[model samples]
Target chain A: MKGILRSLLTVIKNTFIRSITVLYPYDRIIIPYNSRGSIRLVVDLDTKEIICDGCGECVNACPLKLISVEKVSHDKKIKNFYVDISRCLFCGLCEEACKKDALKMNFNYELAERDFSALRHDIDKLTEYAKPKVKEFWKS
Target chain B: MENRKIKDYEEIEGYDIYIEPQFRPFGFPVGLYIALKDGVIINIKPEFGYLTTGVEKVVEGMEIDKAIPFIDRVDSSSAISPELTYCIGLEKTFKIDVPLRAKFIRTALCELSRISSHLLWLTRLANVLGINNALHYCLREREEVLHLIELATGSRLTPNFIRVGGVASNLSPRFIEEFRKFFRSFRKNFNMLKTFFLENELVVNRLNNLGVLIEEDAKNLAITGPNLRALGIKKDVRIDDTYGIYDEISFKIPVGEKGDSLDRCIVRMGEIEQSTSIISQAFYKMPEGEIRTYTEDINQFSGNTRSHIECPHGELAMEISIDEGKITKLRIKSPSYNNLLAFSRAVLGESVEDVEVILTSFDICVCEVDK
Candidate 1:
């Protein structure tokens, strides 16, 4: 009987405490600074061009081979880069393998899509997602 | 009606009952086949292989460094154990010396994983016992631990933080401070949870002396972890086979007096306390050094090695045979396989209603069993 009363006390105490949940659409929780979400390509702040040199480092580092890089013959620039985000492990290995800091994992975790092909990101989508503001936010 | 001869039901064999398998909310599905007689279980057989992903076979021929992510998914509840076992095995085979700071960080993360895993088990047990409040409380505490892991390793369930030579990144001061704060609150809340569960008359009566697994059967079956310790056997891979910075830190292994369902619960609860102390010790004694040793020429490594660690479930071991930098053979000896076998044996002679209680008490991860 004493145990039952103690349990009841605990239940009562918990009832008065503030809730820890956030109303998803109305409110949001602060994600950790180091949280790994989706992969993005870093762009040059001044030139607005991708900093990747088509070096194939991330391609080699990827275990699942989700990344594909094509280089232009004229100036060793990235002609095309594709990432299959549908099957991406998001393990952050590609970001770690980039030598020029051209690859990063941003906080844009909302990657759900209705169509399968929509999930496969191209160079334009990747570069557009790497906003200069996001880089500055992480610096702090 | 009088011309027909009636057969005696007692002369026939025991009835066979098959429990339809269903997907557990946590993942994996388990079914049971029971032989019943007079409301008692004559024999019980557990069915596995519902969630097999061929983890071991998939890792074969992959590079050593790239296989960490796949191995991390072997046991989704505690991802670090198998990754650590595999990394330790590789490190041993290639004769790589992990830095002291890396060792301390690994120990801290591993203990944190243990605590979170035990909390998850507690939530499931509470759910099974119809204690809705305890279930919610356990989940609330478990979320904090998962957040701490995410803060440190950038992912919640599968950190993929530990590497072959060392850890992925250095621990920030903010993470350490936050962990200390969490530790303080967790200690107090844990006591409350203990009293709420253990001291309750309903829980004690329901769990005490139910599905008793004798020490001899546990030993003969080669059971490890809390289930084995519940039988009053003081055997832990972390102590018997010391690894990482465990030799530097001091802690006690909690043992139980009886090998019943209640004893298992007590032993796991005691483990959560021990794990917290270990995390504090590892953090306090942590030294300043590099987090990872530079292993530029990993492709030249070639050898076969086996490494085992005390997982939250039981003894999780990984064996690797590398030839010219490619994995030729990889095998994982998961603890759940043996625990499932023991569960099968323990449920015999118990009433049919106690099967779920005994199954949850064993804390079997079908993912590991199917892997």
Candidate 2:
């Protein structure tokens, strides 16, 4: 029974020590370097060049069929890419197939949206979402 | 009163426990379970896959190599592990070994993926336990690990780095240096997690004797990996000295004495440390070699094949029947399949409020279980 009291006392101590949890939305957590967030097709913003060869590999990879890479280049290339985060499991298989590193995983867990369509993005929008997290390691 | 000379319920080799004892779990099948309480768990009953999307069936009709991405979807979290298992299994069947460099990178990516998966499981359980602070912290570290994967493989989750023969690409020196730094930083912060939430007495109280899976029942249930270890059975496919370069490395397999919620947590934490050790060793010994070893001349020793991997959950066994370099049949038996027994047995005689604690303790993956 004394052990139970000690355990209770410990819980009380911890509760006091950890009462300062961040309120999540009003005060966001600065994501660490190792967080896995929504994935994106890598697009080089400097040149607007897409590394995907329009192979439809990613489209074929997704179980949910959340990706559709299309190429409007003169010869039906897979330059334009679309990913629907709503359906995407964030499995990272689509990025796995891209030999060019054109698609990448970036941390941005705040992907709450009321509209379902907002989850889907074209190649251009994916580039916007693909921003690298400038993780402040020392901040911790 | 029943005679003590007869079965004392405790002395019985096994006992049967229906999980949905209140009602038949057919129409409203959120979760279904059947536990054999032969002094522990004997057999597990699950019907989550009753309504199937037929992923494996669909793959049989598709082109062979095109199946990598589809395989990733089977259990979505750690796509790299499944991809590696399938790609390597296919390569082995065709007698194609990847370049030394690719093999090293493959192991590296696999460890990162395992860490990411454990992080997800940790957060999920912590969330269920109402410890949201740990969830954020775990996800934060998971993002760092994902970035390391991202730097090498491009995609964070579904890294298709490993092809049938060799890995598709290589990691840069700078990326390697950065990744090593990240691993070091993560190590420093890991111990604080225990202090953060694990040390909380309420958490331990909720988990203490809840969902107990004794030794004998664990073995009968075909329990493998950490779940088995949590039951005081030191059965780990990885340490069994099996395939996929595991023999080349040195590591300790952590085991638990009581198959309770706390023991399960200890096993997972021990795995985190052990996985880190393996990654560090793989990192130091990485060699440079051609990543892929398949020939364009498809006619190689290809018929039917199987390869095995020890995942964070347990033994990930895959069997493939190939025809003309294309996969005819691919059957995956994930470790998640056997864990249901442990989960269901742990929940019996448990307080209603502690159900989620037991469930989360088992680290049940709905997708993997359903798959």
Error of 2 at B326 (Å): 2.4
Candidate 1 regions exceeding 4 Å error are A130-140, B1-15
Q: Comparing to the true complex, what docking class would candidate 1 get?
A: medium
| Each prediction's whole-model lDDT (CA) | 0.88, 0.69
Candidate 2 i-RMS: 7.0
Tens digit of per-residue lDDT, candidate 1, span A1-140? 88988988988988898989889878887888989988888888788888888989999999999999888897868888899999888788888888889888989888889999989898878877555445666888
Model 1 lDDT per residue over B38-125, tens place: 8899877676788889987898899988988998889989998899999898888789999999999998999999999999999889
lDDT (0-100) at residue B195 of candidate 1? 78
Model 1 TM-score (B-chain only):
0.95
TM-score of 2: 0.70
- lDDT by residue for model 2 (B159-276), tens: 6567777776667786778877887778765775665555667777777777888776777777787778887777776666465666788988888888888888888888888888
Model 1 chain B scores worst on lDDT over the 10 consecutive residues at B3-12
**Global CA lDDT computed for model 2:** 0.69
Q: What is the DockQ of each candidate?
A: 0.69, 0.10
